[model samples]
Target: MAMGNSVKAPLGHIQFCEENRSACRGRDNSPVVVKLTEARWNELIDLNTRINRQIRPVTDEKLFGKLEYWTYPRGGAGDCEEYVLEKQRALLAAGWPKSALLITVAKDVKNAGHAVLTVRTDQGDMILDNQIEAVLPWYSTPYRYIKRQSTREPAKWTGISDTRVTTVGSVGN
Candidate 1:
């Protein structure tokens, strides 16, 4: 998928990271405006690039092991969950609002399990995945949504796959 199409979402419709722009004016203090700044947005992009280096794609010959919500620092190689979890932690350290980061699962190009990040901004939803460094829209990603866990609970998020997707609840629930 083209990076331009994904990143070029309607800024008016989604949360956006505006640094020099004064997007927040009152006490309501929307989390999106609070977490994402122009500087932090750039940092997320940079961090995503750095994390991509650790990703080793899942292949039959590569060997594998079981992973779950409790495994900390899943180590050198991981499936989508570990990959996205690490990136989420990096974003938090960079000062991006934790609320802005979403741990989402989508159908991979092969119609298998896959994972990516969903960042909500006043501009729209921006997707960040090791597969692509541009941080495009979730829709722009080739994967289709199977599940999404609020960034607030990265480690707490359970089962993120097509099989469990059918039984999961909505974000607000």
Candidate 2:
């Protein structure tokens, strides 16, 4: 699916980017338009599972004694954003194009802020969420889709029109 116009980054995301500027520096902002091969899809699933199993979810308040969102986990545990970061990193290291992998923020079914990795594939936009093990189409989730990193610019982002999407499987924090 075509992405929407650029939008402002979420406050928490901005903070994470600022704190991790060194790592994010010089990142390519071009959109990823490549289609995923069968092997690539398997690899993505493996990476997602590895991170999901390895990183135990912890709240920002508990981890930092305050609200602090990090792009990647500094320790063994982290929240949603960190999961997305790790997955993105793994994909990048595996030679996946930076343009195709995006960090996305959305509101869950309960309206709580959540993060996930959005892989831009030729078939469609697939979401790799910490809350769920199975990778699914972006439109299949119960989230109130908010904004996602711009395909043209990683630092920049674009707004997503909210739709009444239904949850297809078990709920996750």
Candidate 3:
């Protein structure tokens, strides 16, 4: 997805940054697009599948007694944001460039806010969604892209010029 001007980040993300400082620390002004290899593709697909299958889809309120909370689903359950964080963290731990793994927010087909990991690769932006089993290209999804953690700085956000339009505020990213 093409990025737009910087914008205010979702409230949950701000709080997440406060709690998980390291996740939001660091900055690389230059853009990075990963060279996607066949092996890398398989790794991403398998990782997505495993995480989706492992974590129980529980709301933040149910899991943390809050309206919106962002953290790893280490306790076995979490919502979309947690899944995205987990995916991004996994790739980072595997030595993938942090700039290539973005935390994206968008609205689902129902207009409900949803979060997904958007990986910038040589091919294009690919969506790693908890709701979808297959790893799909960003344009292939039925989401209205809104904003995402900037590739240059994970803590900063930039709008996505998604012609479909939207924001997933209530969904928690």
Candidate 4:
């Protein structure tokens, strides 16, 4: 589906993006146009599962005693955005193209804001969510898609056009 134009990121995400500009910057600031192999797919799934299981979920208010949105590579506990940042870093370190890994924000079934890592592959755009153990296509998730980091520029973000409700399912990338 064609996505909407670029949009402003959430305040918290904006803060995180600013603080970690160097980390987010990529050698090539373009969308991924390659297909992923089965081995690469398995590696991504393993990394997602490992980080999700390793990091205990904690709200920013509880952890910081304030409503702040920041992303970091936390070892023990962190919120959704932190999880996404960690996964993105790991994938990049593992030699995955930066354009393929995007940090995305969406609303959950209850309309609560959430974050997930969107992996763009030749097959489709797949999501690695902290709430679910499995990697699934972005369209199959329960969340209402919103904006995601722009492929042309990691610092910029674009709005998503697909708002169709999808049943939760596992789909390989």
The alpha-carbon RMSD values of the candidates against the true structure, listed in the order shown, are 13.7, 4.0, 5.4, 5.3
The lDDT-based order of candidates, best leading, equals: 3, 4, 2, 1
What's the C-alpha lDDT at position 13 in model 3?
92
Which of the numbered candidates is closest to the native, going by highest TM-score? 3
Q: Which should have the higher TM-score, number 1 or number 2?
A: 2
Better of 2 and 4 by TM-score: 4
Off by over 4 Å in 1: 1-37, 58-64, 67-74, 151-173
Model 2 is weakest, by summed lDDT over 10 consecutive residues, at 22-31
Ranking by TM-score: 3, 4, 2, 1
lDDT of each: 0.54, 0.81, 0.91, 0.83
lDDT of 3 by residue, 58-156 (tens): 999999899889888858899999999999989999889999999999988788989999999999999999999999999988888999998888899
Candidate 1 has what TM-score? Answer: 0.59
What 10-residue stretch in candidate 4 is worst by lDDT? 25-34
> Which runs of model 2 end up more than 4 angstroms from their true locations?
26-30, 164-173
- Among these predictions, the greatest lDDT belongs to 3
**Per-residue error at 62 for model 1, in Å?**
5.8
- Higher lDDT: candidate 1 or 3? 3
The C-alpha stretches of model 4 lying farther than 4 A from their native spots are 26-29, 165-173
Can you write out model 1's per-residue Cα lDDT over 30-123, one digit (the tens) per residue?
4453345688678767877777776665532243332323111334665555567678667767666666676666677667766677776766
